[model samples]
Target: MKNLFLLLLFVGYSQAASACDCLMTPVRQHIKSTPYLLKGKVIAVLDDKNKEGRDYHLFLRSIGIQDTVSRGYSVKIIVQQDFKGKYKAGKIIEIHSTYSNCDMLFSAGETYILFLHKAQGNLFPTYCSYSNILDGSPASIDLVQAIRTELKSRD
Candidate 1:
């Protein structure tokens, strides 16, 4: 009986630990699927009341995405109002995900590549998206180029 109980406990813990199993898709595919994608630094993070009267952390000027159809126009990416954490200003982080287990996580002053999607007129990043810290890898470079290419093609 003791052994069985121990086994069950271990199994439960393992499952909980592995809850966020993300199957990463190719960067190009992510670009094609998401409406907004860009790279920028977080300018500010504020604690404020959301529209629903609920308390949430607002990432101010979180990141800037340029309008594909309009030159010299940019869209400011504000993290969804449900996010709960402290994000320091001037941190460069990538956002890729759809509000699932893979939500936004940032370290101050770190550069990242982000993948953003449009949902109900708001942009969100999830853990499942192909976003990561900028490690100067060829794959990261390729992703940046791909995003640039796709944006240009839309013009």
Candidate 2:
């Protein structure tokens, strides 16, 4: 009976550990399926709570956001380059990210290659995507080159 209990405990732990595990998708396939892909530096991080109130409601309604209220923080990023999307360089854009364990959180002053999806006029990165910090490593350089090559081939 004790051994059986131990086995069940292990099973539950394993499932929880892999709850947010994401399968690696090929770069080309991931790029093709994802909507927005950009490299940017996070300029600021703001608490989403500050956006509450009447003006915020009006803004959300104008933007067609009816029910979804993200309880996470807003990350403002300065667009350094856009690999997939046509976001203009030097422009600052705000993207929302939840505090959930499965989502990638943005930090100020750090650049990242974002694989973003748009929902209700908002952009966010998923943990399963190829979105990663741009730390100027060889692997990052190679990935960026691969993305560039793929984009050129399509052009």
Candidate 3:
């Protein structure tokens, strides 16, 4: 399996893929165990501050690589999202998210035109999180609105 994975990495940049699509699967993904994902066009690199206290290096890159093993070419940069860090404008980031942070913090499996880069910290990062609307849910959800609804009072 490891050799197969390495083979996929050898293939340099691939063709363009889904630019915007967030269809999440109910089946849980082993974020830590799976190799880090870094497939996307580094369109724009900027400084982003997540809900977490710390800051991060996020890139407005595109994503699209569902068939890594079959295609023999994966845009992914590292091994598993846990030990990988996405860079924005070429700079490592530090986040302060309070949610699940590791496993449930970052969204996985989707083509985000732009998303925050996640990493654990090192020569490379180790983060595995993707954003996918809950099944039968809208393509996008206003997290702030969700928070307000949860905090709103009932008559």
TM-score of each: 0.47, 0.72, 0.18
* Residue 127 of model 3, lDDT score: 31
> Alpha carbon lDDT of residue 139, candidate 3?
37
Q: Write the residue-wise lDDT of candidate 2 on 1-155 in tens digits.
A: 99999988876875565346778888999889888889999998777336753345435544445525646667899999988776878989988865444656567899999888887888888568788888899989988988899999999
Summing lDDT over every window of 10 consecutive residues in candidate 2, give the lowest-scoring window: 53-62
Clashes of each: 7, 0, 26
Candidate 3, residues 68-147, lDDT tens digits: the string is: 22211112221222222344333323323322223122233432212233344422222333432233335334422332
- Flag regions of model 1 displaced more than 4 Å: 1-19, 46-100, 149-155
Candidate 3 segments whose C-alpha is farther than 4 A from its true place: 1-24, 27-129, 132-137, 142-155
lDDT of candidates 1 onward, in order: 0.47, 0.76, 0.29
Instruction: Give the clash total for candidate 3.
Output: 26
Clashes of 1: 7
Residue 49 local lDDT, model 3: 50
lDDT of 2 at 55: 40
